[model samples]
Target: MNRRDPRVVRRLSSLRRRRLAFVVRETAARVTRILLIALGVLILLAGAVLTPLPGHVGLPLLVLGLMVVLRNSFQARRRFIRWQKRHPKLIFPIRRLMRREPEILLVAWQQLLRSEKVVLRRPGWRVLKRGRKAVRKALGKTPLS
Candidate 1:
C-alpha cells in the first residue's frame, strides 16, 4: 500500500517523459554519428577508385564525419550538465553514502566517469571547493581525514 501524492506522481511522470525524450535524442545522435562515419568510409573508398576526386571529396566527407561525431559528443555533454544542474542535491550525499562501501564506490565512480558532465572536471572541482568551505564553516576548520 503505497500512498503517493497525485501532484508528485504527475511531476514524476513529466520528468520521466522528458528523460525518455532526451534518451531518444541522444540515441538518434549516436546513430547519426555511426551513419556519418559509414558514409565517410564509403566516400573515402569511392574516392580511392576515383583518384583526384578523393582528395577533394574524401577530405570533406571525413571532415563531415568528424564534425558529426564532435557535435554528438557536445550534445551529450550539454545534456549531462543540464541533468547535474537539475539534481545538485543528489550529488554529495550520494557520494558520501557510497564512501565506506568500496563496491558501491567503484560502481558509482564508473557511472561518474561515464558521465559527460563529470568528464568536464572543472565544475566538479568548483563543487568540491564549495563543499569544503561549507564543511569548514559547519565544523570550524576541522581537517578532513
Candidate 2:
C-alpha cells in the first residue's frame, strides 16, 4: 500500500505540506545518524576485544565499524581520509582486507610485510594499564576505551 495518504496531502497548504515533510525527514535522518554512530562504536569495541582472539575477527569487524561511521559522520570521513593520506602503506592493505575476497587476506598480509615500518599500538594499552592500576588503588573503576 502507498504510505502517504492522498486526502492528507490534498488538505494541507503547499508550504505546510513541505514543512511537515521536511521536519519528518530531518528527524528521521537525525535518529538514523545517531543510531549508526552508536552501532559503529559498539562494533569497534567488539573488534578491539576480538583482535587478539585465535580466529582473528578483529580487523574485519573494525573495518566494518569504520565504514559505518564514515558513512554517517562527516568528521570521521574527513579524518579517515586524512589518516589514509598520512599512512599510504597501511591504506592499500586495509582496502584489500575490506574487499572480503578469500585470497585478499594473503595479499594484504604480504603488503603489510613489505612495508618498511611496523606500527606497534601498545603504548595506549600500557598507559591504560597504568591508569587502571592507579584507579584501582583509589577504589574507582577506570572507564577507558
Candidate 3:
C-alpha cells in the first residue's frame, strides 16, 4: 500500500489519461446542460405563442419547459422561488405541477371550480371549498394546511 511501491502506483500516462477523461466528462455535462436550457426556453416561447388558442394545447408544453429549465438551471429555480413567494396565488398551480407526483386532475378541478366561482358567485354554491377539502382529505393532507 506504500506510495513508493511500484506495484501500488499507477503509471503517469494512465494518471494523465484519467485526468483528461474527467475533463471531457465535465465539459460534456456543461454543454449538455446549456443545450437543455436553450431547448427549454424555446419550448416556453412556443407555449406562450400557442396559449391563446382555444384547445388548451400550450399549457402542458409550458409546464414541461418549466420543469426542464428549473431542473437544469439554478438561476431559474431561484427566480421562480422568489416570484412564487411574491405571488403565491398566481404561482400555486405551477408549483403543484412541478411536484414529483403532480396532482394534474386536482389542479384542473380546482381551476374549474375557481372559474365557476368567479363567473357565477352564487352564495349557496360552496363547491370550490368543498372540492378542495374532499381532494385534500383523499390525499391524506389537511385542508388549507
Q: Which number leads on lDDT? A: 3
Candidate 2 worst ten-residue window by lDDT: 112-121
In angstroms, the error of model 1 at 49 is 1.0
Candidates' RMSD to native: 21.9, 17.0, 6.4
Candidate 3 regions exceeding 4 Å error are: 1-10, 119-145
**Candidate 1 stretches greater than 4 Å from native:** 1-3, 52-145
Pairs of residues clashing in candidate 3:
none
lDDT per residue as tens, model 1, 10-103 = 8889999999999999999878877765665566465455546524364334334433443446664475457658896554433343234435
TM-score between candidate 3 and the true structure? 0.73
Off by over 4 Å in 2: 1-12, 99-103, 111-145
- lDDT of each candidate versus the true structure: 0.57, 0.75, 0.88
Q: Model 2, 57-139: lDDT tens per residue?
A: 89779888977887899998888789889998667666666564635657654654444223535544444345556877698
Best by TM-score: 3
Clashes of each: 0, 0, 0
- Give residue 30's error in model 2 in angstroms: 1.6
Q: What is the TM-score of each predicted model, taking all chains together?
A: 0.37, 0.62, 0.73
